[model samples]
Target: MNTSSEPGDSLEKQAGISLREARQTQLLKVFLVMSVIYTLYLAKTLFIPLVFSAFVALLLSPLVALGRKIYIPRTISAFVLIGLLIAPFSFLGVELVKPAERWMETLPKISAQITEQINEISEKFEQEQNQAEIQAEAERKQKEAEEASFFDNWFKDDEPEAKVEEVKEVKENVVTGQIKQGSIEIFLSLLASAPFLIAQMFGSVILILFLLIFGPVLFKIFIQDFPVVVDKERTVQLVGQIQKRLSNYIITISMINGLLGIATATAFYFLGVEDAILWGALVGMLNFVPYLGGLISCTILLMVGVVQYGLVSAAFLPPAVFLGINILESQFITPAVLGQSFRLNPLIIILWLAVMGWLWGVIGVLLAVPILVCIKIILEHLDVLPHWVKLLESEG
Candidate 1:
């Protein structure tokens, strides 16, 4: 009866119901997402390795496919590929140990040099302060004399001589015993944890190997099990595109970083910096991290420069050269190679780095960009979140 009596009232009621349902759906989605994020944070120890393995599998998928085309067994191909990837890094680690130790030994001397420089600067500042005080006192006395009349000057009491106090140095004795004990404890803790860390590393390596070998099969099963609402052909195409694009991005970026590292090492060698190769390798690896990487590379270079060259203007050369190279690479080479499609908003990248870095420390920072890239790809393919996907992209 009411529907027949008033069409507008019924339409308004339907609209209100639809609006409430839509809002409820959105709120549920938001709650579910927050729950997932909290779970990820809580389970990071278990999840980080799995996530890393997935990315590593994605990176190696193309090579594994090529191996299949050549009739090579997946197991054999995965082993060979993983070995090829790990060998150089293992060798680099070994080679870097001696240099790292040498630098560690020199740390005391470097500290002393820095302390001396600070003392010199403080002394200069003190001298300047003293000179300013003397000038100010003279001006004050002059003003007093000028302000006084002839009779007033005669009647004024004799001014006493100003006394300057000598600055006293305080020397406190540090308890070396406690310091040594603390260092020993730290060393012992690290030694105790070494086995666990090694085990975890091996576990990750094994996981990565298995994933590389069976990733395609796992993907196929996932596709089969996907909801019927999602078009199977579109899902397959999306997965393929993600694999190809992500692998290509990783490979291209690695080559660029390698070139940058080589150039940096060569420059450092020519400049007579110690542990050039180690620093170069570190720079290259850290370059995987976005903005923070360049800053870290510059800082390390600057420290090396100061230690070697003793704080001269030339001491800045290494960091300057590094920063220049990084600018060239990040601004021109990287953008040109990655193209517009791969470009990401810097703000989002930094935020992603901060979150992941907080969750998993350095490893998370290293994985942040790749993880973000993968997420961006998935979001782009999902028609439901076009706005979120657009937010991840570069503005221009």
Candidate 2:
């Protein structure tokens, strides 16, 4: 034992730990750098016109190139594409406003319906809690209702009136506390911001239009002199792949979203819902977001349905419809079309929506996934990035 190389073993262990610690430190440094870069990108977004221009340019670049192939002038091709894209939305808004305004008046009733459905869910939960306490009582007779998990723990359909009443009393406060949507100040604030909001609206549209026109030319100029590579060939290749991938993504998403809108509109029409067209259009537009967008569409529809139907029984329609649509989209369309395309995990996508929704509101949520995908794509192609770095950026 005295002759054992104890000191050598200790040294080896120490060395290994030191190496691991150093590697960890290096990783932390890298994380810090990446965070700073993303922060810069977020800051740069206030100048969103430039970003919009880039995406538009990428989307139209292929078409513009095709135009050149057939001897069409690049400038003319850009203008034609912009007109084709912008004209539809412009027409839709003009026609849609009258119907949309008529529907807006139902907002209060819709909100009340949503509150009622929530109350039902809360009662069901309270009954379950009451059943659990009965089960825990030592003197209570062994009953069938006493056994179950949390879902069971909180939702026993059968419970004594006394027990149910007790549970109801406790949960009344808890349930009421959860019903926080808006205060007077929040509504007032929104009303106050209406002018600035209107200006931002026009600014965003004008920004989008400008991007559509000169986006490609700007892209060419931006990449013409890259700091990373000296050879023009590699640089051109990089730019081409980026444009192609982005354009392909956009075109595919647009087609899918359009179909979704049509499908949703058709379903709502059959359901005898009011303003079905507007709701469907909303669903279709939001459908671009994958899992999270679908949820929002479902929530809005549920609220409207609950408001219209005005009963616990009627409230079930929204979730039922939601489940069916999700089943079809997830089991079929997503796997077949958008599977490898998004590659990002559903949870991450949800989180991205939530974060963006918080920072930039609805527009933020709308743009989050696309922006994230773009960032992932760019990071993926960066040669200097490590495997782990690439892995994080990769679609799931």
Candidate 3:
């Protein structure tokens, strides 16, 4: 009786079992990750403010620490810092209203100019098409004439007097009443949401203040209570590294953007563009979102250009100059200032932007890079995922 299996068979059995276990483990991890992503997307409204507060807290942590060192109360420092941060933005918002209203008033004129430009382009295209059709018809007729037999030519009727068809132009009728009603409805809806939006903003500011004051204390408590199985010292180091990197990244990027905004505003003013400050501020804020931000800034500039210059070749100068400035800032200034350590893989950044933008819209897009950097840092510290961290590094 050969009850004992051969050594080769046992080894093969063990290898098969191990392979299946590996696959199962991988599948479970993928499932869990997807579940987490779905949960985040569903709970975005609840989480976005909290995440924003955390980031603000991280940004202000250094100031809070300095205050503590100087014997200032944490609460006082948080309040003062938050006030300083909010004041300029509020002032800028107030300054933007007049320019915004002026632009709104010019919308109808701009629309007319755009329509005329489209009509001109369409007419040029139509003329080219008509010439091509005429030439083709002539060629076909010449070929038929060459191929004609004497009897066939004699039997054909005099080409039916070369009948010309008249084309009737169709004009679309727009109902002004319907448009007005729709605009009123949209305005009412936005008005209804205004209070909610204000309340959310106020809540976020309060949350940020509280987080700034208490975040470090909470972090310390967590470190103390962490399971003995984990290396407490390493955990503390990891936390410190994340805070330092995030703070530096946010502060450096903000300063760069502010400089860019100032340059843009100065350029626009010299170019005689209206609402130069508003456009410049918009460019700075949107530039925080990477690819999409530049696109939006360029589009808005182009629209304003066309409105200002009436579709002339000169209408392109404003956006073109802004684009050049953006190229320089993104390619040269940012890398030089931030250094290689802050650079990230463009492909991964784009994918992360898409995912986050899908999940949380503009807010998601704004936070995408910071979140990606945090993930990269965590993975770098994990013994099992060094490759992932490497993949996230800039190729250059």
Ordered from best to worst lDDT, the candidate numbers read: 1, 3, 2
Q: 143-232 in candidate 3: lDDT tens per residue?
A: 787798877766654431132112302221133334445555655676687797788788899999988888889888878885762788
TM-score of every model versus the real structure = 0.80, 0.68, 0.83
Clash counts for the predictions, in order: 0, 4, 0
Order candidates by TM-score, high to low: 3, 1, 2
Q: Answer with 1 or 2, whichever has the higher lDDT.
A: 1
Local accuracy of candidate 2 as per-residue lDDT tens digits, 178-226? 4333433444576688797677656655665566556656766766765
Off by over 4 Å in 2: 1-47, 109-198, 204-215, 218-228, 339-341, 383-386, 389-396
User: Which pairs, if any, clash in model 2?
Assistant: 128-154, 128-155, 343-395, 343-396
Residue 266 miss distance in model 2 (angstroms): 0.6
In the range 7-86, model 1's lDDT, one tens digit per residue, is 88878999999999999999999999999888888898888889887877888978898999999999999999999988
Candidate 3 to truth, TM: 0.83
How high is the CA lDDT of each candidate model? 0.82, 0.68, 0.81
Best by TM-score: 3
